[model samples]
Target: MKKILPLLLIVLFSCSVHSQLNRTFMGKDIQYIEKNLKMKANKVQNLDNGLSRVIFIKEKDLGSSTIAKGEGTLDPMTTPPVSKKEYYTFILDNEGKVIRTDYQKEYEKK
Candidate 1:
């Protein structure tokens, strides 16, 4: 009974330490991304090939003409240019530094 009690306590202690380590690692990753990438990203999704995906949202006005209350007939502009770009995914390392970046790029085969 004495030996069993000690083994149980050891297991519990190890589990607690593991959980703490995990939290620290996550915090470090968050800090790295915020500092290096200058982005407020959270909740990383790990993908195959050792890549992580991060999501962020940004707001922007339509345009000066559209925002103006009194204008010479606000003509609907075709696809207003993106004032702010939203980073959908960002590949990061253990330190959370961006190792690679991927934007909109469709593959075409001729």
Candidate 2:
């Protein structure tokens, strides 16, 4: 069982590392959010009223899946290079406290 213990620990650690951000930051200020996020946001926008929007994006390469030019030129079926994007949006109040959070995941063809 010695080998199994090490494998189990690795699995648990990896799972925690890749887990999504949680909403435990509700009502917390922007600085707190930034600290926990551990990454800078891709975009930030000021919205109507006293609310502001903060967006964090992460992109993952899905490898090249494109077909050869001449090989698939005549064929109508062809796969394009694609990437996966994850978006996390946070809405903060005038006081810079987080009011709401959103998450979006999508695949884009390049």
Candidate 3:
């Protein structure tokens, strides 16, 4: 039972951590998302015809992946490449309800 207890706790913790962003946000109101997910959008763009887009940016370091081409030795002086940023965008209708969602990840320049 001891082994199972630790495994179960780990599973539950991971589930809550990973639930921050998901497809279930579709059709949910903006307030519900902010309160539940504890996330504030980085930017919001208002579109024509009473539509708006909410964007949340999350940046994470992916660590070094550079391969030495000269002597197969990593250079200590060189800096690692910038990691990709996650963009979570939600399109809301005039009534402030989520209508669609989009997610993308790409490396951004400093």
Every model: Cα RMSD to truth = 21.0, 8.9, 8.5
Model 2 misplacement above 4 A: 1-22, 64-81
Which residue pairs come into collision in candidate 2? Answer: none
In candidate 2, what are the lDDT values of residues 51-88, reduced to their tens digit?
89998888887866546566536655457678999887
Candidate achieving higher TM-score, 1 or 3: 3
Per-model lDDT: 0.52, 0.77, 0.76
> How many pairs collide in each candidate, listed in order?
0, 0, 0
List candidate 1 stretches off by more than 4 Å.
Answer: 1-30, 36-39, 63-85, 103-110
Write out the backbone clash pairs for model 3. Answer: none
Per-residue lDDT of 103 in model 3: 69
Shift in Å, residue 72, candidate 2: 25
What TM-score number comes out for model 2?
0.60
Q: Any idea what lDDT model 2 has? A: 0.77
